[model samples]
Target: MEVTLLFVSFFTLLFIGVPIAITLGISSLLYLVTSGIPLTIVPQKMYSGLDSFVLLCVPGFILAGNLMNSGNITDQIIRLSNAMVGHIRGGLGLANVAGSMLFGGVSGTAVADTASIGSVMIPGMKKNGYDGPFAAAVTAASSTIGPIIPPSLPMIIVGTLTGLSVGQLFLAGAVPGLLLGFGMMITVYILAIKRNYPKGERVSFKELLSAFKSSSGAISLTFLILFGIVGGFFTPTEASIVASFYAVVLGLYVYKGLKFKDLPKILLSTAITSASLMVLVGLANVFGWILTSEKIPQMISNLILGISENPIIVLLIINLLLLFVGTFMETIAALIILFPTLLGVAVGVGVDPIHFGIIAVLNLMIGLSTPPVGVCLFVASSISGISMEKVSKAIIPFIICNLIVLMLVTYIPELSLWLPKFFF
Candidate 1:
């Protein structure tokens, strides 16, 4: 009965358009009140959720990305991408995908990737004769690569929840992240051929070298992060701090793009974004505690086991469930609520928890591009000045491309595990 009230209240609040964090708080509060538990438990669990060294990466990484953006780093990276691939058929579209992959290494969240890259690419694609919906579709789909690469916010949250080696999880995502990016590029190539998309004249070798030289500082940050974590120079949390410090230096000295006056706006933006994420984490922690107290994880495990014990079939079921959940739920909230329960089931059936973490994060990242509640979808569609319905139709093929990659990551554990093993 208590669990029923929890679900009922949560769904009710969600359907009524309450913010997800508040819905989690209220639903958990209802479960506690009805069960005669003291309200102090709420504050206790919320603090427990927020008090983690690993989570320090959230603000640090967000600040790093924001500082770099103010420093004009994104524009440099896009210039490099354009020089390398922007002459191909669907050249601008290819540049969009390439830019997302580069920015993903810096930003760590797909929404940021969508907003940052979409603001530039979507309009440019449309002005260059690309259909508005297709442009929006490509932008939204490529943004999913953000969380799959290193410095990933989702991987950080996954580490906090499961206590897996955050470094290993970070490495595990590298191969599949590259795979997803290349897959999207392939989709773009096919579409470009079929639709007769325009292409630019090939750039001279001198131009490509000049573009790379200009973006070298921004590109170096990507290598800095991967090496810092992989070489044990610092923990992922500390790497974020290092990245932020480097971004500041580059902004002040190298690029001279960020000024003293920009500090207030940049700091305020970081504060607002960080505060919202931390609140969601706190509330989701409380709601997760309620579910645990009710043995919801065990119940879910039993339900799945009742259907089939085959690891392949079980994983397929979990992936489908997560894919559906991603279409409507916020990624972090869903991770906090569902990760442990699903992790337990995955581990019980011989799936590596590390591999499962990559798979789960990959699934939710895809949701950012999906409709109804896909934040990336909304961002892309709005920038393109089209309704979600229009982008939704155009994005379907790309989503199918992503699902193909997700399935490979799911069934082939080596896709995620090989890198961690090779480096370690």
Candidate 2:
């Protein structure tokens, strides 16, 4: 009965459009009250959840991303991407995917990727003879790559949850992230050809060199993060601080895009984003505590194992479940709630923790572009001035492309495991 109230209240508040963090808090409160537990556990659990050293990386990364975006890094990335791929059929679309790949390294969040890149690419694509829906679809679909690449916010959360090596998790995601980006590019190429999309004139080698030179500072930040973490120069949290300091220097002096006057606004935006995420984490921890008390994770593990102990079948079912959940739940909230439980099931079947982390994040990242509550889809549609239905219809091909990549990563643990092993 307590568990029933917990889920009933959770889904009810969710369906009524309450914020996800609040929905989690309220559902947990209901469960506690009905089970005769003291209300004080709420604050206690929330405090415990937020009391982690690793979580400092969240705000640090967010601030760094904001600083870089304010510094006009997005334009440089798009320019470099366009110079590289703009001559190909569906060149702008290819550039969109490529830009997301580059921008993802800095921003580490899909929403930021979509907003920053979509604001530029969606409009440019439309003006250059691409349909609004196609432009929006490409923008939304490609943004999922943000969290899959290194310097990812989702990977940080996964590390925090399971105490897995954050650096290894970051490395594990690199190949799969690239796979998703390339898959989207292929889809864009196919669609571009089918629709007779226009392509830009090929740039001279000298021009491409200029583009690369212009964006080298921004590109170097990604390598700095990877090298710093993997080489033991700094921990993941310290890497974020370093990244922020680097972004500041680049923006204020090198790029000349960020000014002293812009500091207050950027700081305020980072505080708000960081605070909201921390709150969600706290509430999710409380919700997860309730589930543990009820033996929910054990029950779920047993149920899944009962269906079949075959690792392949178990993994496929887990993938489908996560994909379905991703369509409705916010990524971090979903991670905080489901990842621990799912990790148990995956490990029981002899799957490596690092590899499973990549698989889980990829599933949820794709969900960010799916319908019903796909936040990236909404952001892209708003930017493109198109209906959600049109964007949804247009994104189908890219979704299929992402699913193909997801399956590859799922079946082949080596795809995720190779980099971490090679590097570490």
Candidate 3:
């Protein structure tokens, strides 16, 4: 009865559009009260959940991402991407994906990538003879690459949850992320040809070099963070701090895009984003504690194992489940709730945790572009001034492309594991 009440309340609140953090808190509260558990456990569990040194990376990375965005990095990235890919059949679409890939290294969040890139790309694509829905679809789909690449906020959360090395998790995601990006590019190319999308004139090598030189500072920040973490120069937390400081220097002195006046606004935005995420984490921890008390994880593990102990079948089931959940739940909230439970199931079937982490994140990132509750879809649709239905219809091909890449990463462990092993 308690478990039933817990899920009912959770889904009810979630369906009614209560914020995820509050939904989690209220559901946990209902469960505690009905089960006769003391209310004091809430604060204690939340505190314990937030009381981790690794979590410090969250705010730092958020701040760095915000600082970079404020510094006009998006335009630079888009310029570089356009210079490289604008001559292709679906030039704007290809550039959209390429821009997302480049921006992913810095922003580390899909929403940021969508908003930053979509604001520019969606309109630019429309003006350049691309359909609004297609432009929006490409923007939303490619933004998933943000969290799959390095300096990823999702990977950091996975590291905190499993005590996996953040660096290895970052490396593990690299190949899969690139695969998804390139796969989307291929989809764009085919679609562009089928639909007769226009292509830009090829730029001279000199112009491409100029574009590269212009975006070099923004690009360098990615390498800085990656090499710093993998080279033992700094931990993920320290790398975030370094990234933030570098963003400041780039924005203020180097690019001159960020003004002193922008600092307050940027800082405020970071604080709000950070605070909300922390609250969600804390409340999610409380919700997780309730699940633990009810032996939910064990029950889930047993149920999945009972279906089949074969690793391949288990992974397929897990993938389907995550893909479904991703369509509804926020990525971090989903991670906090389901990842630990699923990790045990995966490990039981001899799947490596690092590889599974990549798989799980990739699933959720794709969800960010899917329908019903796909936040990126909403953002892109809004930017394109198109209906959600149109964007949804347009994004189908890209989603299929992403799913193909997801399957490859799922079956081939080396796609995720190779880089971490080679580097570490």
Q: For all the candidates, what are their Cα RMSDs to the real structure? A: 1.1, 0.7, 0.7
Model 3 C-alpha lDDT versus the unseen true structure: 0.94
TM-score of 1: 0.98
Ranking of all candidate structures by their lDDT, best first: 2, 3, 1
Q: Per-residue alpha-carbon lDDT of model 2 for 206-276, expressed as tens digits?
A: 99999999999999999999989999999999999999999999999988999999999999999999999
**What TM-score would every model get versus the actual structure?**
0.98, 0.99, 0.99
Across residues 71-93, which tens digit of lDDT does each residue of candidate 3 receive?
A: 88999999999999999999999
Residue-by-residue lDDT tens digits, candidate 1, 300-359: 889999999999999999998899889877899999999999999999999999999999
Cα error, residue 16 of model 2, in Å, equals 2.1
When 1 and 2 are scored with TM-score, the better candidate is: 2
Error of 1 at 318 (Å): 0.7
